[model samples]
Every structure is written in C-alpha cells, then in structure tokens.
Target: MKLYQPGDTSRAICPHCGKLVSTTFAYRDVPFEDGSGVVKGILAAVCDECQNVIAIPAQSTPAIRRARDAAEISLEVSIPAPEVEILDAAAYRVDPSATTRFRKSLFAFYLQRLRHSEETAEMLRRDFEAWNAVKTEQRKRVSRGIRIPHRRLSFKISPKTDRDVQWLMETSGMNKTDTVRSVVMEIEKDLLGPNTPRELRHLQDIAAVVNA
Candidate 1:
C-alpha cells in the first residue's frame, strides 16, 4: 500500500464533483459517514475542486476507529434473568462462539434498527404493556410463592444510540428500563425464529468482530 503524506497529489473520483479530479493529501477533521461524530486531524485525500475530503488512505483507518471507540458511552440496565438469557440466546444463535460482548452488540443492533421504523413506538408500547401485565401477575405470585431473579447487563454504545433510546422513550411512553426490555422482547422474536433472516449475515459479521 502507498503511504500518503501532506502535499502528495493523486487522481481519484470525487463524489462532490461527480467526476475524476485531482486530490491533495492533507490532515483534516473528517466526520463519520452518519454525521454522528468527527475524527480530528486525520490524513485524507481532499478534492481539489469541491474542497471536500474525498478518499481516506488505508493507514488512517485505525485512527478513525479509535475516534469511534472513544466516543462510546456505556449502556446499562437491570432486568429479569430470563430477559438477559433471551438476549444471550440470540447472540449464540447468531454465532455459536459469541460471548457476552456479542450479546450487547446484538441488542444494540436491534435497538438501532427499531428507531428506523415509525411503528416502533406502537410496538414498544404493546410489548411494555404486556410486560406490565406479566409483572403484575408475578407480584401476586411472589406474595404466595417464590422469588424471581434479576441481572444487570451493561455495554458501550455510541451517543446516537443513546439519543435513539431517548426518542423511543418519548414516543412510546416507557421509561429507560422498560424501553430496553421491550427491545429485548423484539430481539427474541426476530433472532429466535425458525428461519434465519437475510440480515443474519450482517448480524453474524458484527458478532465475529465483536467477539474477536
């Protein structure tokens, strides 16, 4: 691979100009594709015409990845043992060798996907209402019967994901705890299904890197 340096010139297709154009390598602050965050002062190929960072060198990949990891925030929640197990089961089903880390990745993936649909708020409300009913019955059982166990699950997530969860809360009328559980409920139904989804390939790919 060629190592780029400041003032180095090359010919590359610039998306902004919509054609092949001259580019000059320089260190610049580049935003991630999703616009969630920016990686500062990374070496990139800037289009001569539009002044946009057109192509990044292979060597800058690690620095960009580090910026992403640094921006992560921990997402933690406490839920019943069964719900946690369901999440882990989904992870294992995605990749037989996946560990607990993959479980968090799986749920994070589901949470991110849920925010894309307009109907997610309604679905989450239904799931949470059903869980509320179950909890009410469980309390009655606990009065005369056995105790239920709970566990704490935690993982690192991006700020955008945190924002999405908050948005879901506002739309669905569920608190953070119930919101996460409702996500897990959806994860269980999709991941533990009889037929593997086409998106399973993407999930498996994530699991591979996550559990690596």
Candidate 2:
C-alpha cells in the first residue's frame, strides 16, 4: 500500500459528487465513519470539488485506531436471565468461537441501525412498552408471577453507539437497562427465528473481526 503525506495529489471516486474526482492529501480533523467523534489533524485525501475528507491514508491509520480506542464508552445494563441467554444464543449462532465478544458487536450493530432510522427504533420502543406492561401486571399479581433472576452485562462501545443509546432512551421513554433489555428482545426475535436472518452473513463477518 502507498503511504501518503500532506500535499500529495491523487484521484479517487467521490461519494458526494458521485464520480471520479481529483483529491489532495492534507491534515484535517476527520470524523469517525459513523460520525461519533473527530480525530484531529490527520492526513486524509480531500475531495477537490466537494472539499470533504474523502478517505484516510494508510499511514494515518494507527492514529485513528488510537483515537477510536480512547473514544470508546462503557455501557452496562442489568437484564433478566432470559435476555442474557438470548444474547449469548445469538452470538453463538453468529460464531461459536466469538460468542462473548460478539455480544458487544451485536448490540453495536443494532445501535447503528436504530440510530439512523425512526422506523427501526420503533422496534425497541414497542418491545419496551410490552415489557413494562407485563411487569406492571406482574406487580399487581405479586404472588403469581415468578421473578426472573437478573444478570449484569457490560461492554465498551463506540462514542456513536453511546449517543445512539441516549437517543433511543429519549425516544423510547425507557430507562437504560430496560432499553437494553428491549434490544435483546429484538435480537432474540430476529436471530433465533426459524428462517435464516437477513443479517446472518453480515453479523458473522463482524463476529470474525471482533474475535480476531
């Protein structure tokens, strides 16, 4: 691979302009691919016409990796036992070896999906509402319903996902733990279904990298 420095000129396809365009390498603050945080003053290929940071050069990768690692936030949630099983099951289904590591990746994947679209976020909201209703009814009939054991799950997440979780909580009107539970419920429905999940290959790809 070719390394680049500031002032090096190149040609590449520009997504903004939707065509092949001339680019110049320069030092600039570039946001993470998901637009969560910015890595300051990195050498990147900037589109000539659109003036956007089109791509990071090979040599600047280590700096971006360091920044990304530092930007990760901890996400923790106490969920019922079933949710834990569901998450692990989904992870195992994706890749038996990466079961534990993929839990974080699985949640992050859903976070990105739900963050970008309101329709997708509604899945979490609906699941949350259903859970609240069940818990309220169980409280009313305290002697009858069995209390499920709770387990705590914690992992480091990207800054973008942290923001997404906040947005999800705001829209779903649910606390962080319940919101996380709802996400697991959604995952159970999709990943554990009899029909092959549309994202099976995609998730497996993610699991491979996370394990690596």
Candidate 3:
C-alpha cells in the first residue's frame, strides 16, 4: 500500500547540529522476489535543509503492513501475571500449601476482575495452569531445537509500465514491485491452505531456481 502523509510536518531540533530542522519522510513498499518470500519496503527520510538522507527503518517499512495486519487479527492481550510467593526451602517444607495458596489468591483476584468468586477462581486457575504449562513446554521444545538455514538470492524485475516504482516507494513506504510481488506470494501461500508446508518447500525450490 502507498503511504503518503502530505502536509504532515513536525518541527524538531536536530541533536547533531542543534538547528531546528523540518523533517519530511516518505514511506515506500519495495518488492522483494528473492528468497524467504518476505515483504520488504523502504522508509526514506530526508532532512529538508541539510539534504541528509535518513532511512527510518527499511525493516520497519517492509514489516509494517504485515505487523499491522497481524495485530488486527491477534487476540494477544497483555494482562499482568499474578505475583508468586518465593519462600526458602525450609519455609516451603513447613508450609507446603503456601505456594498453592498464593496461586489461589492470584486466581481469586483475577476472578474478582471477571466478576467471579473463589469457588470459580480455583477451577479457572487449574485450567489456566494446565494451558500455561502446555504453552511453556511448546516454547521449550521450539527453543531447544536447532534452526535450519535458508538460502538467499537476488533477481531483477521487468518494469515496462508508467507506474513509477520510486514514487510508489517514497509515498507508500513500500517497494512498489517488491511489495506487489510479496503480497501475491503471500496470497498464493494462504490459498495453499493445508499444503502450506509443501508450498514452502516449493518456495525454497523456486528460490534455488531463481538463483540458478
């Protein structure tokens, strides 16, 4: 998508020269038909007076659309976890139920927020703990495994249209062609559904072919 915030000017004092500089930055989505099938864009910022080019973040621009879309569909709410009681070995042995009680208290507090009581809290806590443990184990499994390396390659594009790739890149904060290619690649992947793994393998093969 093209991103242009025309007439959006912010006054800021530059830390380097201590001069008030008017910053005009454009975000463009650049396309990448290379390996990884990743969407990459360029967020180029130029100092109006100094003519100094500052890249806002190539990764940021490239990743922004995907991240924003992900955020929109995500149900990842950040609620603080309940505080746990840390006791010495001797104390813990003396009061074995202390830890469980602390957990119980936390559940109670959480239940109260949900308009539930201690009775409901105890059941919810057990269920939550079970789910939490499963997630933790999955995390451990993923982390403990060594990751496989992927290949990277570069390729050229055909630009026979009047569509100004530079203009699209600067205004939309995306690589015009690369962004389009990336989006098409993603859509193709999504359409693959249950055969995503196979599709990904095919992608790797295609990447190799592109390089060859």
lDDT of 1 at 41: 96
Better of 2 and 3 by lDDT: 2
- Which run of 10 residues does model 3 get worst, by summed lDDT? 74-83
Please list the residue runs of candidate 1 whose C-alpha ends up more than 4 Å from where it truly belongs after superposition: 116-120, 135-149, 189-212
TM-score of each: 0.78, 0.65, 0.19
Best candidate according to lDDT: 1
Overall lDDT per candidate, in order of appearance: 0.85, 0.83, 0.37
The sequence of per-residue lDDT tens digits that candidate 3 reaches over residues 1-212 is: 44546334555555555677887765444333322232334454556777554334444553755643332311111221211111112123323333332322222222223222444334433444464476457656875875433222112222211123233334334343332322222232233335534333443343344334
User: What is the descending lDDT order?
Assistant: 1, 2, 3
Task: Return the lDDT, model 3, position 87.
Answer: 14
Best by TM-score: 1
List clash counts for every candidate, in order: 0, 0, 17
Residue range 118-154, candidate 2, lDDT tens digits: 6667766886788668856775587466776889899
